[model samples]
Target: MADLSVAFVGKKLRSPIGVASHAVLNEGLSGTEKETEQLKAYSDLGVGFVHTPFICPEEEHPKDAPPGWKFQGIRSREPFMMEGLLVATEARRIMCRLNAGLNMIENLKENLPDDVAVIANMIGPGADPDGWAEHCKSAEEAGADIIEMNVSCPLPASEAKAVQEYSTGEMSEAAGSLLGDSLQLLLPVVKAVVEECSIPVGVKLTPETGFPRIIGFAEGIRNAGAKFISGINAPITVSPPDIYKNGQGKWPGMTTNPICAALGPWDRFLLYRNLGTISLFVPEIELAGIGGLVEPEHVVEAMMLGARVCEFSSGILWKGTDIIKESLEFLETYMDRQGYNSIEEIIGKGVKYIVPVEQVDWRQEDFIATVDDRLCTRCGRCANNICKARTLEENPLRIVIDSRYCIGCGLCQAICPEHAVSIVEQKHPVIGISVDE
Candidate 1:
């Protein structure tokens, strides 16, 4: 049998698969004995590490409802929101009671088998750097093997100190937020925690504009003493939906007030993109590729793209605990079929396949786009969403393509709600210099 074991965050994981931190382990909010038992089950299933939530003691929690929750005004009145707070608080209390000093590292070391590593995930505003630093110390003292600094949450309190701005489609803002002045603002917080904690430190980052920004963040984190990097949290976010209706007035859900973002299928491509970039720049630090990983194929693909570890959250939510065993079995089979005995051999092999533009076959020219006008209500939603040329006119129940500005990127074709857009080869000037030039 091939040895699937791999080193991550300064320890060897029997397998690269691990459970990601989410609502499941927030024992205070979802505090059911069943959940802690589930975590032990995951460890038994060969999970490399199990990450616990950011620890905030009851005292630190709002004296009334909670600081942010009280200020938001919904937690006191809404049962569901208050229930979430209760879970968070209770989970913290449980962790503190279980581990002396409320240290996650100690708790895992005491409760879990020796083979399974325990990681602590901590998030805080930049203004509360000292608070985050103290949390890291507590986790380390408790016996955590690794510390994961979460710097990309989209929630308001979490967002206040977020290292990177949530991407809102503008490439400049997205790129600048992760790399430019913002990184300078974030480095100190990360540095402080890493210095305070004895264990290896890793930073979780969101998918920004592209690879350059991703590379920039990885480099900065490493410079700040981060031992590893976890890439591409929750790409392709949507606007929060309205959760309440007051006659004609509508209100958003309490969680949606700050915007609750989660990862989904649209993020699969981003996982590969960010890891590919990191493989080239920060090859020494272990990389955890996350977001949109659902099946065994995703695990194999992530490894090929230079991810030493892959974090899973949504897959468990959609498929349940059994998916863990299924994913491991599939990975083993995939490794066997490829005649590879170890993951390191295959890591970054796919990166070599990503060729430069000039090397690509430009002569093939087999572009296909089919637009269905039947679904096209002519609401101009597709045109408004993509068409920069303003060639799409309303009222005639049809879309007219302006061949000049359409670079054949197919933005209009893909965004069409009514399926009324199709791409046919029209002679258009090839713009700018090729990579060969």
Candidate 2:
């Protein structure tokens, strides 16, 4: 049997699956009672660890705040077509929406299983060392096993400031992505928090950095003494306006378009991008996956991309803690079938295959897509949305393979509903793999 246990930043986790920090309108304010209950529920469900909702400097947000979590699945007639959800709330939900994070951390430590660790997702006031250091110390004192600085949240309190400097090419020194994107500002705080806490410190990075630069951000965090990098909080987006409400944004009662965060399933790819890049470039720092993860399979995808731990937020909101159970059960069976002995064996296994676009050596002469006339129903389903390769023959009323037009990209084979299209070895160099080894 393969062991699922994984070591993250010096802490041994029972499994790599855990819950990401997110708002729970109930206990985020009053105290750690409800938050503890949720943590215990996760522990009972067999999660390896839990990240408490963001705790911030007391001045981050008001205690009695508006309802923060409002999310719903979005899918159109085209299923799986960029399927994802939009997340919005008051600008500040940090420190569990008013500095209740420490209490929650303490209570969680008391109620959760001793082996089930708690990660404090604390945010500070900009890049203030004293304040950020204090938050880290408090969480460590409260028995947190890890300290996760909330530098990358899309909807940080300083959102208004972020929007302005984004266009000016100067970032504001405020909480959230603004601080995460500004390496000049965030490195000092990372050093402060890392120095203040006895527990491992991780910096959650924003997706705004846009690739190659993200590698630099991870390197900076590692140099600043941070132990881990959690890839992605969420991507910033503008809510679409409602056509019926005179172009006002749709939110049931609201009619104004607001910039919000995009969360849930689709963000998984973005999470992978960060995870893979950091794993490949910055091998020294540990990596965690925290976006677009919904299904049990997504956890494996993240792990393959070199995530030491993977968190569930929208998945737990949608499917409950049972996702944890389902994931563990699936992992045990998957590991056994795949002949894995431990999680370490597979971590970063995919990195060797993920070369940069320019480094790929194309093998174009291997195979070209062909149509099996016996299987072709002439439904024309394979002829849809083909950018370079759409081979359709109308002579005998059946789909035929035109090698001249077909680049053998496999788009036709993938989209074929009738299973008529397939790629086969050809004499000439025609088929091109998406990533030629």
Candidate 3:
């Protein structure tokens, strides 16, 4: 069997797959117990690591705050096909207080298997360098194998009302994405934490930081002495409204739409963006892929794109602990089949193929669209509407391709439903002058 074991930031993890930081169903002061149980359950499934729900530095939470989680496009029988989820929870209801978080870490360390590392997913006093350093030091003291700075939770800036209030200086701190997006604000915190803590410190970055900006963020993080970067956290957005109900909100209990977190499969591309960009430009720091990964194959895809570790948040919520088990099983089988003996062999393997558009050799003349006449349904979906290179003829009600104009765009092949259209290398080159001539 192929070894799933991999070294991540000086720690040898049993597998590259683990759980991401997310809210749990626990409530009240004893919620830490529930979170601990959940982590234990994940460890029992043979996961390499598990992040505790976002833990803040506060010692106590308010008594009356509310918590909620709702989804859109959810069919009771098939829950996996959700458009997104709205996570609106007060600190009292979702996060672990500093004391509870430390205890949870201690409990998991004692009970979990030796290979299962307990990562502290900590949200510090936003943008406070010293306070952030102190908070992370506590987690390290509590025996966390790794400290993932929760600067990308989306909650602090997700609410439109809160943001408007924050804009006017009514609120002191809008952390999470607000912190992750600003290198000036976050770099000091990262440096402070790295300086204070003995364990590996990583930043869970926000999706709001895009392309060139994220490249700068990664470079700054590497300079700050942090070991790795994880995320594209669920981006903040308003869920789709009910068009049939005069634009009412689609969440289960709400009539009004509010800005919230978007998760699930839609996040995979953004995760790839982080993994691929940082791997190419800022190769010194490692990466952990999170956001939009929902299947066993998605884990491998992240690894191939330069993610050393892959974590699932929405996938676990939608599919249960079996997601981890199935992913581990698939990884072992896939590695053996593909002749890979260790996880390092697959990490960043696909990154070399990624290139700027200007560098791509379009190869427009090498291929053309071909339709298998036997399987063609004579559907004009491709030719009539989209591609000028293909034409529908009435003699036998057939679709024909004009290779001279095809350009090998593959629009016709992509639109065909009958499995008839294919883009294949042509026997004759269209662009080059005839050698025989």
For model 2, the stretches where C-alpha displacement exceeds 4 angstroms are: 59-65, 93-99, 164-174, 372-377, 384-391, 394-396, 418-420, 427-437
- Measured by TM-score, the strongest candidate is 3
Assess every candidate by TM-score: 0.66, 0.90, 0.91
- Give the alpha carbon lDDT tens digit for every residue of 218-320 in model 3: 9999999999999688888776678899999877788977677778887889889989989999999999999999999999999999999999898988889
User: Which wins on TM-score, candidate 2 or candidate 3?
Assistant: 3
Off by over 4 Å in 1: 29-34, 57-59, 63-105, 125-130, 157-181, 208-211, 240-258, 356-437
Give the root-mean-square deviation of each candidate in angstroms: 10.1, 4.1, 4.1
lDDT of 3 at 147: 97
Task: Evaluate model 1: give its lDDT.
Answer: 0.60
**What ranking of all candidate models by TM-score puts the best one first?**
3, 2, 1
Tens digits of per-residue lDDT, candidate 1, 1-437, equal 77778877668778888888654444533232545566677888878777775444232422343222211111334223321111111222222222322443454577787657787765543334565677677777767788877665333313333333433221121121232225655677778888888889888776654667777777888888989877665532333334453222112223433322445455678777878778876777778877778777888788888888887876776678777889888878878887988977877788776656788755434432334555556666656756554344646556555434555566766666555666655433232211111
Quantify how close model 3 is to the true structure by its C-alpha RMSD in Å: 4.1
**Candidate lDDT values, in order:** 0.60, 0.77, 0.81
